[model samples]
Target chain A: MVMDLHVSLPRGLTLANPVIAASGTFGFGPEYSRYVDIGSLGAVSVKGVSPEPWLGNPPPRVWETPMGLLNSIGLQNPGMEVFVRDDLPFLREKGATVIVNIIGHTVDEYARVASRMQGEAGVAALEVNISCPNIKEGGMSFGHDPEQAYQVTRAVRQATDLPVMVKLSPNVTSPALIAQAVEQAGADMISAINTVVGLAIDVEHRRPALGGTTGGLSGPAIKPIALRVVYDVAQSVSIPIIGMGGIASAADVLEFLLAGASAVMVGTVTFQHPGRMQQIIAELPQVLSRGGFRGVSGAVGQALPAASRPQTRGGDL
Target chain B: MAGQQFHDGQVDARIVRREEVARDHVELILESPALARAVPGQFAHILTPGMLRRPVSFSRIEPDSGRVGLLFQVVGEGTAWLANCQEGERLDILGPLGHGFAPPDPSRPWCLVGGGVGIPPLYSAAAQWRESAPDVIIGARTREWVLMQKDFEQLGLGVRVTTDDGSWGQAGTVIGPLQEWLEGHADGQVFSCGPTPMLAAVASACRGRAAAQVALEQRMGCGIGACLACVVPARGQTQMEYRRVCTEGPVFLAEELIW
Candidate 1:
């Protein structure tokens, strides 16, 4: 039987499907254009961009350990000007709704980037990245604090007419607190569970493998954590939530939706397979039909009862 | 501008050729028509036991036969599993990826050097530099790891071999042999591939002698440019200043690289 899998965002942006190329995983959209038709999917959140270009961390920046990948890329990008000047045109030509991810060192930096991108054509939304390790703030992360998340969200919300999305970091103690703070500060949506903080040892070198000493761990290793955060944040705020962290298949996407994510984002899996975005987009309908659902939204937050989820260690899987 | 396909668990072909050169490192000539079109320094992502594609460079290309040769060391689980691969067994591979060796010029006398696994690409450079048969130098911990000596000699070129343990050839580092060679005959370009320290030493050794190019190895996700995983600080570029070993080069001008 044919099932309707179309999913729409809270703002006016509607998608043909529910699969989004998570920001930082999928570069400026066109990089994957060769592997798959970009227009065939829902939307793409371009790589994280800051006010100025980032050189990123030093060598040995990424490491793979037991079904997961850890990276300390530090949001390396070509800055806002070049992204709008050189990158946006290509993404626009690809014909897919482009979600621009903006990050900054301070609140004014966030507003400046948002204001510049405010009236830009073809940009579907602005995703504010508040999860970076603040070098100036004595190693305290931006997303770990609710007030900081609110300040960044409010600043971007006030600066741009475009729908503002505040992406949350999983390393935070209370993702719900941060999510609620953003909702109160007028954030349109929330993308939960950026890579959790982790590290690896190079045994041979007798030191941390990543040049940054610690990195954001993604892939299957963080899938359960992502699911839990999405579930918690969904219960905390009335705003829409885009769940992500190590999504590998359509089944994985279903897990996020059932956990209360309005939509889902694909990350680490894309690194293993560049063409995975299209495969997930094509497979979502089959997943809906198999579950006896008529549409993708029907699966959102349809988790089993507390007695049914079968308490497995640290909350629901 | 043809379309590209992305699917996991897809193996195009898996006919293996048994060509054992040295201990621990064997030259596997795999049957893959798709990868034969790969350029000089590009690599293929071979499936390791636990990990996905542990990146390996294409040491040489035999287009007529659609066979690509890979020279690898059995250091970790990936290489050990790869080393045990049989002649008829099918191995999952993602192809002709990353960047390859830069195009060689016939007018130039290219001097190629390698240490251990780095010696692989020099074979390809030697095959391409047929006219001058560019001077080639190779070094290893001992005689056991020194490979392709016969292959390099068969190409009718000057070949120098060095062993840190003094078990073979010039009983010293590759730069020692190269220094002796340069003291007498001094008119050729330099091209090297190997471990970072050896390349750095080669870069330092040839400080005022001639131009040198080296291939860098880095941890990678997508062998394509999309992931931005394998990046090295370039010597004299700005902004997008770092060179992606996967795209910009596994190979680069020795002077233009930070190391």
Candidate 2:
């Protein structure tokens, strides 16, 4: 209570702690609510939602890697329509700040999904999932290209009054460039980074273990890469950054914050234990007090030296 | 068992009895009332030593005594640690997860086929329908690998055993006798739980003739529906979309299975 874990991001989305349940891992708050008190968390990003109910990838969709997991789930979700009718109400009842993650195969699909959620009562913000394949341009992911990232982010930003946080994929060469493009396109916040692409094969069967052949890797293996992405992107944009990708412990939260993330999201680590967020939240004060920080925001972007700080970006950042 | 595909209640279950079937396979009887809620095909997500929970199927349930049985194969470091756990020790289990098998009509011949590690759940399914005298086929690599045959036989259910090396009742796979039965029988249904190859063979044999439900195995992340790790390709009304094997089913209608 004395540590002041409160973090006020763009669009007035406030959190009780820096550790929020990442999308896909939390599943709109209902799944983990039974094991832990979900209402106490900073925020919970619901699973990636599409225009229609997506069936996702075939069997063997998930493969286990060393200290990580590769999943080609293909963003399996109940469509935006069904989510609004059935799932969103329960999330609202939980009283936790909800970040609805939306994805699309086309720019119109992203915009349409965003617009449909504009009038929703419980949603705190929209996290655009540009990692989805851009069907308009031969199935290349929108987040991989700078122009597509900007166009998709702009479409979603224009479609909704809610704060837009673009969740960028780490597959790109320099996430800083994409972060700059989204910030220029009116993105209120940046959630870097999404899963890194990876592949796993079944040696005994002499074939791919995952039905999708390849998948997005998430977990402890990608933590360093994600930290670098957050560090690089923080200097390039003034927008609040919600950092994630294998964040599991209180110490991990501190690392992301110091690496220039205003708040952090716990993604794949929750799969191991559902109530892990509670432990991290409880232990966060000890971590902050140990590091001589007064609050969660006190640690954001502290790793960057004075000379490395952005010269032009001057607001609350 | 919790009346849905996903439930958050993680039960602390104590081991009441431990039966070692083979070198790596162990059958443990856990005492938990929440387990009484579980049906035949449903499984429990048990916390192992690793970073993820292990999915173990429910072998039997004594509802009145508030006890359930679990079958696990110690194939790795995580399960090996779990298998070594002695009686009176406790396990954190999230149950009664996933959809259980719904038995076909009793009037029709119910063929319960199980191979290798898949034999456990079939025992529970057979015990439930024992009054109807279901035909239980237990298949293994050899007679030494065959398990729960006596359990099924004690219920007076017709038991047929098959082994690959022909060290048991029938030679070759269980599908041989299963195919023979499916071809002659008019009113019958097949419920299979076994290796992927066995299930696939049964599926192909029973295709349009015998209605079947097969239990699938997958490497799961969160035993709850949150992680889309446990999924199988199942055809919906319009398209062949992926269905979550963990949530929508561990048991799916054989017709909808892609392979």
TM-score of each: 0.93, 0.92
List, residue by residue over B129-237, the lDDT tens digit for candidate 1. 5675788889999998887887888888778889999999878889887776667555557788889989999888877786777888888766666667788888644
TM-score of predicted structure 2: 0.92
Show where candidate 1 strays beyond 4 Å. A133-140, A304-317, B1-11, B18-20, B49-52, B185-187, B236-240
What local lDDT score does residue B249 receive in model 2, on the 0 to 100 scale? 83
lDDT of 1: 0.78
Q: Name the candidate that leads on DockQ.
A: 2
Full-model lDDT for every candidate: 0.78, 0.83
lDDT of 2 by residue, A187-284 (tens): 99999888888778888889988777778888888999999999989888889899997887889999999898989999787776667788888888
Clashing pairs in 1: B40-B101, B41-B99, B41-B100, B41-B101, B42-B99, B42-B100
DockQ metric, candidate 1: 0.39
